[model samples]
Target: MKQQILFSFSLFLLTFSSFYYPINTASTAPASSPKLAPAPKSPSPASSKPLVPTLPDTSDSTTPDDITKILKKAKTFAILTRLLKTTEIVDNLNSQLITAKSGGLTIFAPDDSAFSNLKPGFLNSLNENKKIELLQFHILPQFVDSNNFDSLSNPVETVAGKDPLKLPFNVESLGNSVNISTGVVNATVTGVVYQDNKLAIYRLDKVLLPLDFFPSKVHASAPVAAKAPKADDHKDKSSSAEDNEDGETTQGQKKSGAVSFITIEGTRTMLVSLGVAFVAVAMI
Candidate 1:
């Protein structure tokens, strides 16, 4: 009976040992294998942002030529327009009209009839730089109507005159009429040729000659006058011969060397002068 009990116990022990320690299978993973990295997350729909606002566009708006268009319509202002063109201030005027932080522009323009009274060849006598200064004299960088005269701080300098020191201008207002003085010539506002918030144009019977250009007096002795004729005659004879000899040379040189500054109004002072004369004749 003891032998039978021992044999049964031994069989049960063997079966338990085989079940606990089974043989390794081919599909089993190794303990030392490297782990895979996680995938990157996609951007969310809520991450999109709105577009930023931009500045106002001025590309299609009114330009500086708008002033010229208005000025060209007025026949009496032909001389002023011509001078402005000569100095290349028409473009500057247009630019300042747009860019000026303070007053846009104020122009005290003289009529063709006013220029007609000047000494012959007066305009022709001036050099290029003098012509620019002359044109600059007529312009007040800030826009001022006749009503703003009393408020203006004088001696208000101009854009041209302000380089070394301000080309000073004085304004005095009485009733509806305004008088402007440049310490040399006095001009009264005869009419308002053009007026806007950005610009003001006042017609003057006389040109506003800056003290920078013209003097109040000229001093010459009688002897100098007598001697001038002989010297001038000598200069003229020599100049004529030199002109004939150097005409071609100077012409080509002037064409090549001289900086050509044409204006937006076209280079036609002679034509403008003729137009002014035509208008004046028609008025007569």
Candidate 2:
């Protein structure tokens, strides 16, 4: 009876141990594997700056304010901004563009490359008045779109100035392309930046040379077909020509003497003829 009791107690202990062992294993398996880490916090948007400097987009609407805003955003026109600031005309142009019912500005803006391509030190050498004139030359009192340039009259008067004839510019348009000729420089508009009733900005392949600034270059020195010699210079020229002829003759004689003296073929022929003569004399 004691053996039976002990066997029942042992079976009961074995069943309890089996159940507790699996529960302990299930609890320990979770602790053995790695737990995921929390994600790193992102930097604050307010503290971050853009890699490239960019002004706010102002192209959604059109106004004189857009000009200044676009200029600040456009890295291509940085040099143009510097020039406008230097000339102190940025505010004036901006004012004209923003004013109600005022004539807007048509600006032919040359790219940075075009300005750099200009002759070194050419702009720096100009006087203050010439610089102002150059700035004025690029601007027209009215906004002129590229499409209208084809039919536009020659000498489109610019804010720069005008004569009784017409404006300083001769604008020639072919299809979408337009060529601007300032008696001095001929440039084709490569592209348009901004176009509106108030302001139009066109990019040019070259810097427009103002006729007033470059009057000498406008009409090239023509090759004279013939020039009548002045009576006073006639005698002097005649004497100089005769002197040149005499000098040339003297030089020819000197060169002939130098070459003819040491010519091996001529000297050899002469020597051979003399030898034959000596032989004939001996025979005689």
Candidate 3:
């Protein structure tokens, strides 16, 4: 009975030893496996501000060097200062003239005397709206000199307004003169005396009528046919008609001698009157 119990115990020990040995061997092996790290996130899109455009400085660099130099000169400023004293508008005009780009332009600069000669309250009456037109009249956009005046026809269009001012170019053997055709009633004349680079100055006798002066036609005159007849023409036609009528009366009286003197005179007078009427009608 003791031997059988000992044999059972030996068998159980052998089974336990086999299982324990395998488990211990697995735990003792080297740790060569890679570590599990968190997945890397995609980088956020780059945040950047939009660029802005800048404008060039026109006031400082764009102005021509020559124009800048001219404005700085003492003599030029002195002349301009004197012009400004007369009226406020002249000062504004001076500024524009000096700064203007060099282009062929004829400027009819009015003097203090010219403004003084203007009709009462004329300068004061000019409103802001009309000022541009008045200024335009004095400026010819194209550069024109004294020499160019001869080619321009009377009533040349000005910047002043749509109604072109009649500028009649009168050329004589000596030289040329510029006359403003105001129409049959009044005519104003100006003479171009000074010329500078892209600028011409004219001395005017009177202030030109503002473009708004006449509603019918601004500075336009009647056609030649509408003009009044000359004095000499009137006299010649009257004398010629009287002479023809007298001659007809004398001839008729001689041919009708048999008629009574009174009757003859009456008949001759009527015929003479008819002939004179025909002559007068034809003359017209």
Task: State TM-scores per candidate.
Answer: 0.50, 0.54, 0.38
1-284 in candidate 2: lDDT tens per residue? 99999999999999999887766656666656678899899976662211211123434464646465665554677677777888888778887776749667788877788889899998899887877788788888886755566546766888878752222688876545578887667997776676667787777778887765655543353334677878979888988999999999999999998788769678899999999999999999
lDDT of 3 by residue, 1-284 (tens): 89999999999998888877655755698978998899999999752322111112212333232322332331223322343344354555456666777665565555446666667886577666565555566566666655555555545666654443443222121133344543322323344334466555555555555534554554344344566888988789888887788878877877676467778789999999999999999999
Candidate 3 stretches greater than 4 Å from native: 1-103, 164-174, 184-194, 216-284
Ranking the candidates on lDDT from highest down gives 2, 1, 3
Off by over 4 Å in 1: 1-64, 162-166, 215-284
Q: Model 1 TM-score? A: 0.50
Could you tell which candidate, 2 or 3, scores higher by lDDT?
A: 2
lDDT score, candidate 2: 0.72
lDDT (C-alpha) at residue 48 in model 2: 24
Model 3: lDDT to the true structure: 0.52
**Cα lDDT computed for each candidate against the true fold:** 0.69, 0.72, 0.52
